[model samples]
Target: MTIDTTKKIESLIITDQEICTLAMDVIESIRQDFNNVYYKFLGGELKVLWSNQNKFNAKASSSGDLKSPPDHSVTLYYATAIRIYRDGEDLYDFVSSRLNKYSDLFEKLNLGEPSCLFKDLEKEHFVKNFFFSGLTYLFGHEIGHLVQEHSYIRRFFCDSDRNLNASGEASEIEEIEEIEASASSKQLTRRQSLIWHVTELAADHEAITWCLFELVRQAQEEESIKFSQDDWHRLKENTLIFSCAASCVHFRFNGVKAVYPDEFPIGTHPHPMLRIEKNVFQIISGLEFFSTALGINSSKAEISKYINKGVISANIFWIEKYFDKNDLDSGLLMLGGVINNENTKKYMGLIVNEWEIIRECVESIKRYKPFNAGNQDLGLMFFDENFKKEFTK
Candidate 1:
């Protein structure tokens, strides 16, 4: 199992010398992967860039090719790269002990006692995979924003609001004033906030698609690695859950919280748990779709056995970072009480409903195609009309 750490191809310009060499390598891997992914799904290309602003942030928007059939930029800031590197080193081989049911599956993740390598190199590889997968989640999220054309839609409505507010109707100027209105930014109205939540969740939905695909690539990187299709299916399900769980923990580390939040997140972002559950739904739904298409048998319970592992691992990392070992019991008990529940299902419905509400805006203005279809998109889950219909029904 040799990794070509020195392997290089044309990728993002590395301006952040503060980012560790290993971390940059991971970013390069992602850049190469995205080159194929974007073309396959979006029928377009993107320019990847690195920004060293010393902030743990990333963004997507129109690039210099903002002409017809424009290309976009997905920039990863230095602070975020540094954090990804450090977290990979810090959380290699981290998961809850409550996963004996699929212990073998995890071992495939290089998560067990090192049989060959001394001093925990297997665990190191496991964390490296985790970090890279988490990073794919982040990078794919920004791509989600681009593919979905969220910024264009936002600007359209924002401009429309400005015009409407200027030409006040029915003496609404004073009323709009008292309502704490501001067409200048995102603080204009409740509906604006709701739109924010919906778009962010949609971006997350797109992110998981890329994240799962990248995991599959990483698993098969070694020529000797193989699995029975059944074993491989379970591996995809379990590892995607764990990888996304790690990313969600990282999300929480970035100040996103929602251990037991309201049915709807009160901010622009969905609750961290809600986002995690949404990701799980994508995994199970995707597996179900694959099973149906491939004529295989996969049960909900079978595919779901490893669901709690991510929560357990998240609790361990969160408690250790934010609390202490003493709170581990309570944290594990409390961290994931809402996942896979009826409440989450209903809340997910709301997200779909909101997306469908803006589906026309997305369809009318999207700059690219994705496994293109008129009514459904398996590649970008939430964009599929049929899935939205059945899902919300």
Candidate 2:
């Protein structure tokens, strides 16, 4: 597969440069601790692209005396970065507004000043960091796919033709799935779908791990004032919650929910709400474990209540936006109807039950034990040099 890298479309945006810089900073931060990886910023409308000669090929059966350049590269498009930022801004506005209605409840939790935090969210630096951290998770997710060797494992067990397109968009695969009815005939299709969903979940796990690590590191580096261990932990947990909320809104705004089984089956990208719920569960569970390990008798339910407020706000925003309604009451009814559906409930339960395994997988990845060692030879590509200069000007 050949791509025309020279098809210059438009110039890069400043936000794009900042997002790329954040991603690079993350890669650099983890470079020494883990195997090296490469990144490039492509100038195109497409959001992101990961290129590798064997991206769609099965792993080699045996080691060979082969010396070649790194086979994988992660590419971020300037236009997509802009889209994410804009969508993030919209989501922040929506979620923050909704949260304000329940400001009293959040304030009672001693979780700090809700009004002040919302004010800070409007600041230029905070807004940038918000988008930056969220994009970092997304970029980390792509890197997860690479390091986890998802493509290799997938191609090894399934036919390459069953793979989704490079863009990772919904395609004719659903149509193909519909044509096959026999249980034996559908086995491969089901396997292919399951792998895709599992890989996506694996990537989400990686994103959450990296996001939490980055947030905690940022909190530790604060020098303006000293934070008690408990305070720091609270701050870290809240920041993670906020970032996860932002991510939920970000993906929800950009993605369409699968209203029909054929359009979105068990194997495609899980519903944005399910993903959000899973992240919330995992983060809260991890916090519970961490607090216990530290001998802190923190109220897990209290912390979760605060976080769930935000999650519920974001979910309501999503529901209102997607559901046609004249008022809040009608929207709530529609949301209830959707949530009560047998299919939605089944998938939600399945995802909820998988939280323990997902948490375990994330913990393992955080230890830098990805299935593949990742490619070290790729190094950092200078694809964004000109964009950086242009943006700085």
Candidate 3:
């Protein structure tokens, strides 16, 4: 069914409490699995809220008295979720239409009907999984920023400018300075820009790690589900696809591109395409890392083959076709030359090293029995209180 694109986004005021609930559940599950003391730092403080902003975006920030421990806040704009859903639905329709057109060719070639390949595209299960995984990646990345103390680090570096008050929003002058820093022709020094880029990569790594872990945990916990080896492979492939979709949504909505250093300096976040490439690489590297770490005897070569054939090839084709048909500026496709295989391999090595550093820090924290996951429910009760009602009007 075609989604109505003509409706004013502000009038579509629905909030998916389920998405917020699932995000909390996923974070709780990860905390349960680790049971490390460090995880508790964010347990009570991290909150997810819905905002009625007309734009497609989300922001993570800290709140509470500066003297006391601050609470980390994540606001998922309603318009952002609507945009993601609409785009995803459109992509599904496009895929389904293409499959129908190719069904006759497939039959002549003795390749089963193309419809069977995407039978689940329109199903509720697929829609839920797609949004679940995508939202998890987005929310989890923000949580990563908090848990990694990026804000605290930023405060330390820009202490004079970032004196936090009780409300947690930046001071007016600080906000202006931030805007100026981002928009200025005089970019942050290379060292400062690299720090920002590394922090972003670190957050991406954490997001991918947690999302993959949660997906596997959920699959294993399913009482009625029996997954064979092939099923596990398919599950991993789907996780990657949803993760890519999440990145693409952010890239498209935010108008992120790979700006050449000569043309424009780096910003607080790495180029959007760089972020996508890293996420794709991290999934593969993470699979390899976890498989070996868990003694699963899974071959990296086999996983790479699966990714190349199943996820990477299919997504590239579909995304390119989608952008071409819509006439959207194709930053994603143009990123190929910038993030080629050699660069990806080098970045993979860097991620492994960075992960090792992060792992050591996490391991240093004493382990504890799992916290009461039920306590997280208290954080979800403020959704209505926190919703940005002004935009809806």
The model with the greatest lDDT is 1
lDDT of 2 by residue, 231-277 (tens): 56545444644554444433433344432322223544554544565
The RMSD (Cα, Å) of candidate 2 is 13.5
Instruction: Give the range where candidate 2 is weakest over 10 consecutive residues by summed lDDT.
Output: 56-65
Better of 1 and 2 by lDDT: 1
Output the better candidate (1/3) by lDDT. Answer: 1
Clashing pairs in model 2, backbone N/Cα/C closer than 3 A: none
| RMSD from true fold, candidate 3 | 11.9
Model 2 scores what on Cα lDDT? 0.44
TM-score of each: 0.67, 0.58, 0.61
Assess candidate 1 and give its lDDT. 0.52
Candidates ranked by lDDT, best first? 1, 3, 2
Residue 159 in candidate 2, Cα distance off native in Å? 6.3
Pairs clashing within candidate 3 = none
Give the alpha carbon lDDT tens digit for every residue of 282-366 in model 1: 7766655555544566665555544444444454555566544555443223323444345655665666777666867777665
Measured by C-alpha RMSD in angstroms, how accurate is candidate 1?
A: 8.8
Better model by TM-score: candidate 2 vs candidate 3 = 3
Q: Candidate 1, 15: how far from true, in Å?
A: 16
